[model samples]
Target: MASHSSSKIAIYGAIGANVAIAISKFVAAFFTGSSAMLSEGIHSLVDSGNGLLILFGVHQAEKPADARYPFGRSKELYFWSLIVAILVFSVGGGMSFYEGVEHLKHPAPITDPTWNYVVLGLSLVFEGISFFLAFREFNKSRGDAGFWATLGRSKDPSVFAILMEDLAALLGLVIALGGVYFGHMLDNPYFDGGASICIGLLLVSVAIFLIYKTKGLLVGQGVEEETLDALEALARQQRGVEQVRRPLTMYLGPQDVVLALDVEFHDHLSAIEVEKTVDELQDTIRANHPEFKRIFIEAKGLSGKQRNPLAPDPTSPQI
Candidate 1:
């Protein structure tokens, strides 16, 4: 819960920064007639909107489970994150690419670049602050894995979406700076358009990556290896349990997981004993993994037909 709260903090910070930067970039772009500058403005504006959507999603995700939705609205976060990816592609990437093509066809000289430089510099600073905040929040839960691995494993989409948007913004600013400088240096306006195209491509790539990542979380994904292991070990500790099958786990949200286990209790155990053992096992599991909102344990033989998530080896890492 604390980590989720931190993600909201990071998101709120990014929203403020992007809104300020977008307004400045639009003013400068209007004055300078720089294609790259316009693209940057659009990028910031899209990011600002995305931040709002994420906040809304986060709120909706927290809605308590009701008759209509038994598992609650936790997946709403994933749905909104997917929309963020779509927005980046359609608004940021599409607009920039279209502007780039138009500018390349009939390039126009940029007016006084002084304002452009000033705005770009300020944007870089704002984006840097936002990026740092996101990275700090993300780094808190990243463990020892590399950044890319952490991104892939992260269940929270709000933090990562902001991180990627800020990352793209920073890189886009650098490209915009180069384009503006060189367009004036060589008396060629097409360089500005080329930079816009590059920024568009960058946004496209970031959007695609976000889509891929969010899809897994939205559809449902397995719990981490350590978490599954702990649950499995807890089940085995129960008396009269001869064997435990691979536990099936699904993430309903970052903090909510549904777990199911197929266990074969010893044939010698009485019905009352089996019931007693089951209750103890559940208590132990809930104590160890508070994330398990629902746990279903069935008494069934391991016929080798039902695949075990922990199969192949008892100690191997889960996917």
Candidate 2:
């Protein structure tokens, strides 16, 4: 709950910063007729939209588990973040590329200089502030992990998504300012067009990367290797469990996992004792791995055969 609240606040800050940057870029584009500035404006607009989507996702993901959805609504975070990435690629990158191509075909002269640079400078400052907040939150969650590791392993997708977007925004701002500055230096509108194309390409690349990671989560990817190892170790240490036959674990959402384990237990335990041991093992495993919200355990003897007389066939051939 606290994490979700903090993410909402961070996203709100990002939205405010992007709004200011969008306005500044729009004004600069109008004053100088710079394609790069215009492209950046569109990028900021997309970022603002994505921030709102993330905020909504944060709210929805906090809902408690219900009958129809017993796993709660955490996966909504990934679903919404994926949509944001697709929008950035389509609306932000695609439009920027189209505008750049148009400018290349029909170049326009940029008249003003001072106001354009002023707006670009202000945009950099605003985006920098937003990036700082996102970085602070991400670092708090990351602890000793490197930045790339945090990006890959963080349970809160919103913070990581915001971090990537903010980084891309900062780079886009630099590219836009450079395009204008260099275009003026060389007296060539082509420089502005080229810079716009580069910015679009960068945004597209980032969006694609985000989509790839989010898609994996949405498709029920397995838990991290470290998490799986932890679960395995806990299972092996439990009494009456001789060995772990197979352990299957998958992430239902951020910080949530569903685990299925096949274990070999001592053959001497009676039915009631076996049930009690299994229950105790479940409690122990859950206490050890808090991330596993759903657990299924199958217990068998050392020979890989069930000890209970009424146990289902282990290898029943289907017709």
Candidate 3:
């Protein structure tokens, strides 16, 4: 619950920063008619939209399990985070490209350079602060991993996604400032259009990268191998667990896992003993692995036959 609250707060901060940056970039673009500034404005506007989606997702994900969703609503975060990534790619990247192409075809004069620089400089500072907050939140879970590796491997996609967005925003600001300075220095609008195109490409790359990473989570990727190995070790150490045949685990949501295991017990163990063993194993798993939430234990005889009458037949086709 505390983690969810923290996530919500971080997303809200990102939303606020993006909204302010959007307004600043819009005003700067209006004053200068700079293609790069305009492209950045669209980027921030899209970021603002993505931030709102993340905020909504975080809230929805906090809902408890119900009849309709026995596994809980945690996956809502992944779904909405994916939607946010797509929006960034389409609205932010696509619009930037379209504007850049139009600018290239029909060059527009950038009348005022001073205001563009001021806005870009201020945006860079604001985005840096926002990005720092995201970084701090991500580090809470990252432990010893490097920043880039943490971004790639962290279970919480929101912080990493926002970090990428902020980095892109910072790069866009640099591109916009460069375009304005070079356009004025070289007396060429083409340079400005080219810079906008570069910014668009950068945003597209970042968006696609984020989508690719988050798609794995949406599709029910397995827990980390290290986590599984740890769970297996814990189960093996239990006195009644003869063997852990197959341990299957999947991420139910960020930092939440559902674990299913097939275990063989001694042939002479009574039904009561088996139940006690299973309960002990479940408790051990939960105690050792903070991420594992729901555990399902399938007890098997020495001959590898399931003890439960309702267990699915091995040869039966699954739906």
Q: What lDDT score is found at residue 195 in candidate 2?
A: 85
User: How does each model score on TM-score?
Assistant: 0.89, 0.90, 0.93
Per lDDT, what order, best first?
1, 2, 3
Question: Distance (Å) between predicted and true CA of 69, model 2?
Answer: 1.8
Off by over 4 Å in 2: 271-273, 303-319
Can you write out model 3's per-residue Cα lDDT over 94-205, one digit (the tens) per residue? 8898899999999987877988888888888888888888877888988888888777777786778887888888888888888899998888999899888988899889
Q: Write the per-residue lDDT of candidate 1 for residues 66-142, one digit (tens) a residue.
A: 87887688889989999999999999999999999999998998868899999999999989999999999989878
State residue 183's C-alpha deviation in candidate 3, in Å.
Answer: 1.6
Off by over 4 Å in 3: 308-319
lDDT of 3: 0.82
**What is each predicted model's overall lDDT from 0 to 1?**
0.86, 0.82, 0.82
Q: Which candidate is the best by lDDT?
A: 1
RMSD in Å for candidate 2, one decimal?
A: 5.2
